[model samples]
Target chain A: MSSKKQASSQLRVGDNPLVKWLLVGLTLFLTAILLVVPLIAIFQQAFVEGAAHYFNSLLEADTLHAIGLTLLVAALTVPVNLVFGVMLAWSVTRFEFPGRKLLMTLMDIPFAVSPVVAGLLYLLLYGNNGWIGAWLYEQDIQLMFAWPGIVMVTVFVTCPFVARELIPLMQQQGREDEEAAVILGASGWQLFRRVTLPNIKWALIYGVILTNARAVGEFGAVSVVSGNIRGETNTLPLHVQLQYEDYQAAAAFASASLLAFIALLTLLFKAFIEWRQERQEATL
Target chain B: MSILIEHISKTFGQFQALSPLSLDIQEGEMIGLLGPSGSGKTTLLRIIAGLEGADTGRIQFGDRDVTNLHVRDRRVGFVFQNYALFRHMTVADNVAFGLDVLPRKERPSPSEIKKRVMHLLDMVQLAHLANRFPSQLSGGQKQRIALARALATQPEVLLLDEPFGALDAKVRKELRRWLRGLHEELGFTSVFVTHDQEEALELSDRVVVMSNGYIEQVDKPGDLYASPNSRFVFDFLGNANVFEGKADQGKWLNQQASLQLPKGIEQQDGQLYVRSHEFFVSDAPTEQANLPLKVVAINPIGAEVRLELSPIGWQSKDIWEIDLPHKAFDQHGYEKGQTVFVTPKAGYFFADDLAQPTPLHW
Candidate 1:
């Protein structure tokens, strides 16, 4: 008992040895079973036949096209969500108006609703038979059952990440610095460039990273809207499912492995950016 | 430049933040907008700086109507309460921001801008920390840098919202003296908002006291101190002990306690306000006065010894506090639980619902 007392610092709460070991043991055990094992299984199954088979499966035309289409959707969706997210965050944080609280509550809709439901909603609203889509169909435009539909649903599901990361930060920093800049005779553009942009740049970057990660990995929403087209509309995750359903387990695992690798990279970027922002605030 | 404000008022939603009011400020004079929070002092300062527009009336800066001008075009310097030095910029860059943002046709050359920033830095006496980011500087240093940044464009008017409010007492005092000196040297029209009465009295050439969105009084510091026009001003300016009673045969009495009203005062029921330094404590009640209090606490640590007393027979809203000079306290050798009679040397008496207080002295 004396030894245990000496081992634990007084500053810490929940300092019982048995409780501490139980919590740590449960966390590590659950992580290995739920997360680590699945990640390892993806790579093992992908290379089970042989490294040559795994590489050849990845090099197939449909797989390559899926990868290309996923990248394009992410590239397009990220910038669209980035602009929309920043504008949403900036408006909610910086301005006061009627229905502002309602607007803010509305921003969280994508985050709360199921991604598949979000996709279905978009399909109902923007499909060829849908109200707005009927007009666009006459003009020979197709948003659903295509790459544009995939990108649209992807953008919807990913829009909140950037805005969610930024609102608290911008609110904490407050409008004092911007007001000071304005009083110092800075034009609107200059105030944003010289004052507002620099402070929020790190959080902005962090948000963009999360948005990209979600765009690349989104499956449920993209599935409902994508129509499962083979080479033209299949994203990485949708392609993985198509491969598995076609009895190509190795190809499915290979595609899933690529997603796991991207997720790992995104985590690394997120950690580094969080550390940079911590240092920035510590200095302040 | 002189500033003339006419019938300026503002409302947010349903709350009237400021009532229509007007004042003229002379060039090179320093004015303090003194009021408690929600009294609209900060709102008025922001309005004058063009950071917030008044819902009605016009503002003129020496004959130029600035009522419709954007904050950026008003040509006034403003220092925020938090200093608001750009967190990402070094001290030099912060001070240079005002000059750097000027239109190219009017902007100074880079070398000239650098020199001007350095000169302002030297003026604030922290030129050596020019390379340090705002976070690296102390609170007092950051405040000076904020001032230098505000002054960089050489605007003819300066506005500050609680300039030294974030600093410790010692730092606040030091900066108050420094800012006053800078104001004298620059000779610009200056206005600052502060709820700290000592800051207002010590630093302002004149103080404008406001309450509930109304201007209560505007006078030189000494005159304002001597003659507060309303109850809000009287209570806000200092710690005061109040005497509530009715006049009977020239003596104002509450319960068994009563005191003679000075001659030439008409008979009326009202509350009397007295400062701690304006009354004296003695062993027995005089024929003209009887105010009995028991000392509950004695603190002898500061400039004067302080005593916390409670009324013996009369009623008071709070515990009465009285200050005594150390020499007198030592001579009297007062102790806790000792009863004493207090007599008023002077006070301001307000009649029922009267706006002005009648000054009384003995």
Candidate 2:
């Protein structure tokens, strides 16, 4: 009986090596074709004109403004979304109430809908002759083709990032630590700042990073809202499109490479953060 | 301080988590709420800690009516089963959390907070690890830090919900003893929830045995052990050899065995529960020997030998286990497949409170 048990319990190697190798080969092949190829092509095209030309294109006044506008939009959108996301996640995950599922589904709307649809939805709400837009326009507030419009669309596109990252994590963490803090004489805000915030900080950062990336790189939505006004409301992705349309191929790829670099950095940071978290958990 | 819970009750949707129950915990008393998982022990603890509000109840902490107070305002310290320490905070910061969160006017100075935190860490014997985050601490160390944090605010009452439930057996035993010592030193009114009857009995000034959202009994360990009020308490507190039989005119008889009842005992159908150690075994069947049993298995566990027996005219269902001292076993020369007559040394008979026979499955 013991020998049979030991025999069954012994760790078995791959039962079918062919299937294992096939799976590995297929994954690597698909990854190379889909992800690696596009990444390499962007850099290849950007530097096809010498490094000096690529740098000169990057330093162009319009390109600089587009980069600045993208950064400003991301800077503004990320913080707003970060606050809203934390509040949304906290309310949904920590409290039990009627219509919580409905609220959660609403939060996920930005993720489910196309960015173009999201921009259109905001436009309907705030465009000239639109619902709230008509009243706002009568009050002399320009929103449809301006910076605020760009920001509004960015916010809508990135709304679910932080909350989506945090909700499941906070839910899994449960209410014990918060309850303990409360019992230990922590006020509501103190409980949140001390206990809840620290627990969800890493997830919050991960969410913010993704949200910032999306806000900077958002194309379809920002395009629908911004009117593609150069040096004014054109974000980096829209700027890339404008350059491409104007036959400024070197400039477009150079700009594209910048966004791609940001995406790569975000991916690397995310991987590092996850690795660190895993290491910490392993030590624990 | 003493806590008065008046007719406390709670329900989660259709499930009643706590029935209308009242308990008075005196100042400096360490009370154990002992029960199975669904028995509302943890719920009651949470209610007292003001972490959960009772649907209908008035709670008084000393002279103050704290039933309507927020958990923070109630000045109750709570320790959770999972240790619930702030994962990102070091041991010192965790211990200082309660004090640091106090309103600015009431908050201690930074140096004062540091001193107090270190003092608490020293008390828990974790001062050496004060810089370590909760994740770096062992389960036992984390729990001790939790206790220290809960105590930092000088709460009027301390409540723990299965505080050591996440720990291994050896660590649990060590922490239970440590908690007992700490409770004695601090002299705070405390109530802890635990399902382990031995833990409750060993560590509590008094144990409140609960079942199905009702308090079954409350007594000192010795008293509760000797005099369990209900069948649930009797079964939950310790192991028992339960015999179901009908008493008739100073004698009791079941399908497979007969025993003489003590004189003047009422004639009634009931179950008799005897602790294993309360049964005597002998080689010969005398008048005092009530049941003739055939020993089927002898399990030696430390100083005692547990004899698994079947009645002489055994049906498949008729089996009894009795524990004898190893010396007694040796003296009697008892072995498997040998005949021995057994009699109850001490036991309890509950009228009409028969234990349901456990079905045997192969």
Candidate 3:
């Protein structure tokens, strides 16, 4: 009877015993080597010497400065992306216009283009020798090769996260609730805060988490514009690279562990939000 | 309040959703905008609610001109098809939203808002559900809560977009009756949009039937059903059968079937339309008409026996339907594939050039 049941179940797609085992084995092997090992390796190496050593390396002045600068960049980047993302999603989903489809395509440019290319584009426009940069240089406002440069490139690279997360959700939830609120005498702000925001809270937070994760860990773009100036232009990722190049392997891994920790935290929060959202939908 | 809409029109880029049209809704009147999909009935209702702007028009609520007013400032209570209740808020908060959103000076006190919400909930007979989320309620319960929420601010005009569309049939009928009672008790001017002929006929004091972004007819439900102005309205009302024939010498002719036109209904190139209920089946041809049709199917259920018939000696692209009282059906004992004669007791005749159909009776 059990064998018959198994045969019946195998009638479904991709349920053959050998094929399933092969696929599962391949997936497990690849995940263990490609993802699990590297993640564990970072933490393992960070504390290889001792917890005291790890703390000392992370608490170094340059490392501390790099940490603060990374947090600051994320702080500036997340809010800008959040506002821009909500507006873009709202416009494309709620209203119709000639360029609406084109605008949605344009929003995905940040995701499509290489982060280094994005940084280079910003540098060319805002660097010292470029057209706009020459004018800014005369006014003594430097954007590239400084902390501001890091923030700008990070913003450009992470801009699509919030909007990407929000677009499909807002499209699904639709403009009806907002319309209802407006017809019930809700002002513009009231409509958003009361009707629109509550429906999208989880998605918006998920977007923020993605944006923050990308902003803090962004390397290719930040490298192009940051100039790798230790204690000044250096972010944590840059500092980790510099430390690795200087042959301070343990210290580098210690700093890498911080980014890894944040990534883990982001994953945990994302899972929780997804679970909560599922519960919410089940109740509905 | 009476709503006076003048020359309202809207065009969405290449597609014109609404052409230049107007409607006058009397004070305390419940009007229904009824049409098929994409017929601009919802668009007309949205424009009236100020959820959408009209291209060229003036909207006057009572004596107040509100053509350019924003929806938030219009003070009109609007309910959406899916209830659109705040999912994050409890039913009480959803009901109190309108009162809470009023500008500071005019805003009711927190305690007053609570009392009014409870009172509204009580009126809808869902006061026990005040603490529950909208998700917890059934479709009918949610609909009642939505109505109570809409009434919380005591607006003079209420607009509902396909109010009971998503409910089951029994719930829809119940909600329809409940809404009618509420509308009468409140005495608020109301306009609702629906594609349902039955709902519009049962609930509205006057129904505005639309087709292809234009108003087809506007009249009391009884009058509208009895005399649909155009062919579109006739088809939209459902269960209508048409016989395309030419009229000559006071006789409508198609093949061997001939139906004599009533007095003053003689016209060239007319199409006769008959509702299923308006036609009668007899074992022999009547003096007024001779439409020999073979019974394709007989549905003996409900209050009547419905016959699906195909013509025996006439040409109709579609099959014809006739309904008989069960007693009559039992007496005749009609069966499938049996030849029977059908006479349209009452029908409307639409000519090739005329927009309005002529009512015909034998």
Find the candidate with the highest TM-score and give its number: 1
CA lDDT of each prediction against the hidden true structure: 0.93, 0.87, 0.91
Model 2, runs deviating above 4 Å: A1-11, A15-22, B282-298, B308-320, B331-341, B353-362
Query: What is each candidate's fraction of native interface contacts (fnat)?
Result: 0.94, 0.98, 0.90
Best by lDDT: 1
By DockQ rank, best first, the candidates go: 1, 3, 2
* Candidate scoring better on TM-score of 2 and 3: 3
Per-residue accuracy of model 1 over B158-227 as CA lDDT, tens digit each? 9999998999999999999999999999999999999999999999999999988889999999999999
**Model 3 TM-score?**
0.95
User: Per-candidate DockQ versus the true complex?
Assistant: 0.87, 0.77, 0.80
Off by over 4 Å in 3: A1-13, B248-250, B261-268, B284-288
- lDDT at residue B192 of model 2 (Cα atoms): 92
Checking candidate 3 for backbone clashes, the offending pairs are none
Judged by whole-model lDDT over C-alpha atoms, candidate 3 comes out at 0.91
- Residue A33 local lDDT, model 3: 100
lDDT of 2 by residue, B1-362 (tens): 99999999999999999999999989999999999999999889888877888999899999899999888788888888898888888889889988988899999999999999999989999999998888888889888999999999887688988988899999999999999998988899999999998899999999999988999898999989877877898889866877777777666787657777776566777777778888767776657445778889989998888899887763334367888888988887877898888888678877884443212111
lDDT of 2 by residue, A1-284 (tens): 99988876673666466888899999999999999999999999999998999999999999999999999999999999999999999899888999999999998888899989988888889999789999999999989889899999889889999999999999999998888888778887888787888788889989998998898889988899898889898889999999999999988999999999999999999998899878877876
Better of 1 and 3 by lDDT: 1
